[model samples]
Target: MSLKFHRDKLSPLNIWPGFVDALTALVMVLVFVVLVFVIAQYILGTELNGRNKAVDELNQEMNRLSALLMRAKQDINQLDAEKTQLSEQVVTFEETIESLQSQNMTLSTKIESLTSDKANAAKAKMSLEEKMAYLQSQIQELMSQLKLKAIAIDQHKSNNQVLEEEVASLTKKLKSALNSEAIKLANYKSEFFGRLKEALADQTDIIVVGDRFMFQSEVLFDSASAELEDNGKEQLKILAQTLKKISKSIPADLNWILRVDGHTDKRPIHTKQFNSNWELSAARAISVVNFLAQQGIPTKRLAAAGFGEFQPLDTTDQDGDYNRNRRIELRIDQR
Candidate 1:
């Protein structure tokens, strides 16, 4: 009974040792598994971090590519707009070119018409010039004929001018000769007047006037009588002597004479010997001329004239005026 109990106990102890070894082996296996798991987790975490970094880099690259695409799209759109503008400008230029071509054709046709007109005008000008040349030739021939006729007229005028000059010269010479005689007569007359003025200086009633000597009617006659007074005869004797002296100095060619002009007042006179004032005036002048002739003065050198109040020294109807008008005027003059 004791041996069996001991054997059972030993068998139980042997079971406990095997069980402990199995537990330890199980613990070591669990530790090795935990270590492997930790290593695996570390490696996995490192690999996951590297992959996440790569993914973030790839995301940034994609964002950059998208921005580039947007810019390219904008450039294409702007290019399209510029192309549209260029097309419009091309259309305008083509239209302008066509208009210019039409104007050029019109100018070409006008230039051709002008050229034809210019040729026709040149032909007409040539014909007109020929007609003008013919007219000029005719005018020249007429001018030559006129010049010949003018020369002939000039020759005739020259001959007539010679005869006219000769006649003019002869007339001039004759006039000069006559003028010389006249000058001599005038000088002698002046000298005769000077002598008479000195001789009759005391006689206030006798006055010299413009180549003539005036004698009052009262000095020569009484009242309306033609008979000369004694004093008048003395005056006539002095005039006769003066005339003779002057005549001796005068040239024979000078036909000088002493004229006695008698004047009467406007009073009417009718008498036995005188019918009117004219007759009385004429008788007075004749009496003076006859008395001078009797005093040895040449009859041809004496003249008598009467004026019945026609030529008056004074025109007023007064006593003094009548006295002045009723006078005898003695003039020495050319016949």
Candidate 2:
């Protein structure tokens, strides 16, 4: 017989075994729940660690951006300062130019006034010249009258000797005076000639334009080229040195104006550099003027002019006839 198992049939040892089995299943279910909870916790912890690393990287990027922004701001400030300085310089330059313009205008007005005065003075000079001419005529007339009177007095034979003596004395005085005047003129010519020769002694194309040192059409320049050769420069150097010295000794009344005038042959130069004789002549003049400038002469005092075969000494084209046309005339004038 078996003990009652609460309205169910059972073996003698079945109740205990079933109770143990049910307890074991319940323990297994609890263990599975714990394992699930551990897995979820581990996943959550890993995600939290990854989020923290991302936040740290974002912080570093923000810091880097901040540094670049600061540098850019400093650069902008420097540029703005430079711009302001440049603007100030421009304003100062404009003010200076305006001041110069006003001063120039004042000088122009003074020049106009002086020009009128100079014109009026020129008329007065003409009047003085006329008076001097009249005086010279009167003096000549008085001399003629004196000669006639002397002739009449000498006609008497007794007084002839005395008259002759007086005439001889007058003649000697006139001769002496003429000799003195002639000597003065010769001295002037010699002085000018010496200086011009000294100036042009070293130059090839330059001719000392006086009574001495002969330079004709034959030896002055290249037939076609206005370009002065090495010899030409040498000659120019001597001339420049002489002029520099001569300028120091010129009369105070003279304000010497140095002009380099070029002349060319009648033939045209159709090269790339020059179109006509005028251009070639002009280039030669400029070349001479530039040489003078290089010799320490002021640019303001030097001027260039070209006379293209127009003012020839000889009318006909013959051998050596072009000498007059191919010339570099260094002219000195009181300006």
Candidate 3:
């Protein structure tokens, strides 16, 4: 048993060696595997760290690039704004240029018009200068003529003084003769008038005024008529007879004249025969002068005249005033 036990221990010892070898091999293999796992973990960690660093760098790069892009956009926006302002400035410059061009054109036209007007004014000035020279020469000629005329006027003044003296002497003699004749004629006129008053004593229409005899128109003619009535003819005949008697005593060179003046009232008259009171008054005076001529009075010694309403003895607006204004007047005067 002991032997068997010893043998058994020896056999187990052999097996233990084998088991020890196997354990040793397994330990070596496990150690190798652990080493390989540790190496792989280190490598993986390194790789992961490298990858994280790269990612961080890439993120920083992306952030930088985004900032650059934002700046670029801002620059683009600023450039666009500047471009817009430049465009507006360009438009304003263009409008200002157009306005300056229009002003320049207007100034050019005004310059041309002023140039033309200046030329015309120069021509007119030249013409005026020539006319002034001509007028100066004419003034000199007129001055010479005035000197000659002054000399002739002096000579005429001398002659006129002599003639005035002679005329004064003759006028004084003539005035004395005329006064003598006038006195004689006045005496004859008084006698004639006295005789006429006696001959026409029954007639009330005749009146003697200052150096005149007045007869109402009603006593001579009908209303608005120029013809002589029968009573007017008779009265005129008596006047003619008185005048003939007075003429025989008057001097032949007395130069006496009988003036028959016809007057009219303010009333207007319109007829086929007489257009106005002036014409009617003129016709009545002519009729009176013609009747006196037929009564043997010389035509040269008789005168006729017509006075319209312009000459009024009475200016009152009354019937009696109008009647007094309408009359015939007889006056004796020098021819």
For all candidates in order, the CA lDDT equals 0.77, 0.62, 0.78
Winner on TM-score between 1 and 3 is: 1
**Please, what are the lDDT tens digits per residue for candidate 2 over residues 33-61?**
99999998798778757755654565565
The TM-score between candidate 1 and the true structure equals: 0.54
Q: Assess every candidate by TM-score.
A: 0.54, 0.39, 0.51
Residue pairs with backbone overlap in model 3: none
Q: Which runs in model 1 stand beyond 4 Å of their true positions?
A: 1-154
Question: Which has the better TM-score: candidate 2, or candidate 3?
Answer: 3
- Output the TM-score of candidate 2: 0.39
Task: Please give the distance, in angstroms, between residue 83's alpha carbon in candidate 3 and its true position after superposition.
Answer: 99
Q: 100, model 2: CA deviation in Å?
A: 76
Can you tell me which runs of candidate 2 are displaced by over 4 Å? 1-192, 198-221, 251-253
